[model samples]
Target: MAGIYIHIPFCKQACHYCDFHFSTSLKYKDELLHALVKEIKLQKSYLDNETVETIYFGGGTPSVLEADAISLLINTITELHTVSSDAEITLEANPDDLDDAKVKALRRTDVNRFSIGIQSFFDEDLLWMNRAHRSRHAEASVKRVQDAGFENITADLIYGYPLLTDTKWKQNLDKIFELSIPHISSYSMTVEPQTALAAFINKKKQQPMNDQQSAEQFTVLMDAMADHGFDHYEISNFCKPGHYSKHNSNYWQGVKYLGIGPSAHSYNSEARQWNIANNAKYIQSIESGKLPAETETLTEENRLNEYIMTSIRTMWGLDLDKLNSIAKASASPLLIAAGQYFDSGWIKQQDNVLYLTPTGKLYADNIAAGLFF
Candidate 1:
């Protein structure tokens, strides 16, 4: 199965810790929309004959688009590609934009899922992150989606911000459980380079993130999610049974997907391509009948490394057989090293499926890289 991702390149405001490609201005929005539709038609053959089972609208803030604009884009894509009858179409929305009217219009479209960015439910934490929505809007948007009869929903939450105490974090977790939300993608606060949060920390204007707190918060999240009967399907994603995100799950499972729009990346087994990150440049190039993207063919080493990194992070751990087949070498030494972690109760294996234990997840990245050929 294949997937399609459309990147919306505008946001109402910039979050302090966000590093995703986005522009704060909407001056070129109409041009960008036209470019996106044109790009979809131009790249219609990227996925070959595979049926697209998922279509995700991601990036800056997909919900910021007018309903008619979103409809036009979706319709344009449908005209160019073979969309599965039951495709999972998702839109990444900010809470502020998920108003009653917007949600109503969204329900009428092919968009079957909503991935809301409810970073935190606490007003204080919201302010610290410079998010544009309030705590009430976060809660209300979810209610509105449910009230509007959309069940396939996921909300993102952030923990371990300096302003979020254990008690407050628990409340956020409890709210999701209490609301019976089907899916959650939660993460610890991180200060990426070139982000406002990183600059604040460098200037000593804001307190730096505490690793210890992050670890504790992660543990708390694991316990709470498990207690609520959510599967730890991936490192950051948790969902009730049968509620995993089709688009993202396909991504982690190495399925080919075509990513359209500025700053988007598309992959089809052999190589990957990324569009220009600048909005204006993207529109101009697409208008000139060119896809304004760079391509990279994957080396065996690069592919193996990607497999190791992504596989180890999932519930279905790294596959030794797959590794041996790809590398054409015995992975005994790597298996032996992994066994040390297994002995320490950091990892476990059963039915040929290896996955990280709770303790190992804290060091997942380091562990996965070490097991690489």
Candidate 2:
């Protein structure tokens, strides 16, 4: 099954660490929505008539839009494409935008899942991240969504920032557990170049991220999640059994998906494409009856490397038989490269499947790169 992702490119305010494509102004909001619907229609055949298993509304903040606006897009998609009956329709929202009224409005739509960006429940951390939501808003949003009868909820948390002390980090984990949210997507603070965080660090206005702190916090997260009975299904994502993000899981498993919106990426096994990052350009291109995107056809080597990189990060690890089907020569070189890691007790092999050990997960990227063809 395939998936569809709609990127809402507007935000009420910019987070200091965010580098995603978005505009703070809603001047072209209506026009952008029209263009998004038009793009969905234009790219309807991208998935080759596969029934859409997931429809994700990700963005600068999808909840920034009115519920009717969201419903319009979903309606447009369902009409133009073949969607599954029980499709996992998820909307990524910021805590501040999810008041009771908004939750009630969303309940009328087909969105069964809500991925709230409650980065931190501490006012200090929230302010430090320049988030628009306060701690109260985060707590209230979770309760409101649950009370609204939406059980498939996931809350995002940020750790390893300068302001997040070890005690505070644990408190954040404990708070999520207390709330009993089924899924948790946690990320370490990284200073991307050209972001406000990076600029602040360059000017000495903010401290740079510490790798040691991030590693330590990640360890704490894993232990806590284990004790709490959450499955560390993928790096940076943990969920209770059966609550893994179907959209993201499809992506990691190499299932084809179409991404609609500025700076969004799409894959269909053979090629990958990404839309232009500029909102005006995207709108203009769509208005002119053209797609504002670039495409790259995946070579065998590219596909093999991608599979190795993505699958290695998941709990299932890499499937050797599948890799062999794609590229027969890849397995030997990969196993040879993985030898050092295996000897070091960082990786284990069983029944031709490779998985990362607990310690090896800390350096997952590096190990994956080493095994690349």
Runs of candidate 1 exceeding 4 Å displacement: 325-329
Worst-scoring 10-residue span by lDDT in model 1: 323-332
Model 2 segments beyond 4 Å from truth? Answer: none
lDDT of 2 by residue, 1-373 (tens): 9999999999988899999999999988999999999999999899999999999999989999999999999999999888999999999999889988999999999999999999998998888888999999999999999999999999999999999999999999999999989999999898888899999999999988999999999999999999999999998999999999999999999999999999999999999999999999999999999999999999999999999999999999998888877767557778889999999998999898999998999999999999999
What RMSD does each model have against the real structure? 1.2, 0.8
Writing each residue's lDDT as its tens digit, candidate 1 over 1-373 gives 8999999989999999999999999999989998999999899999997899999999999999988888898898788878899999999999999998999888788888999999989898999999999999999999999999999999999987789899999999999987779999999898899999999999999999999999999999999999989999899999999999989988888899999999999999889999999998899999999999999999887777788888889997888788766657566777887877887888888776678999999889898887877
Q: What is the lDDT of candidate 2?
A: 0.94
Checking candidate 2 for backbone clashes, the offending pairs are none
lDDT of 2 at 348: 95
* Top TM-score model: 2
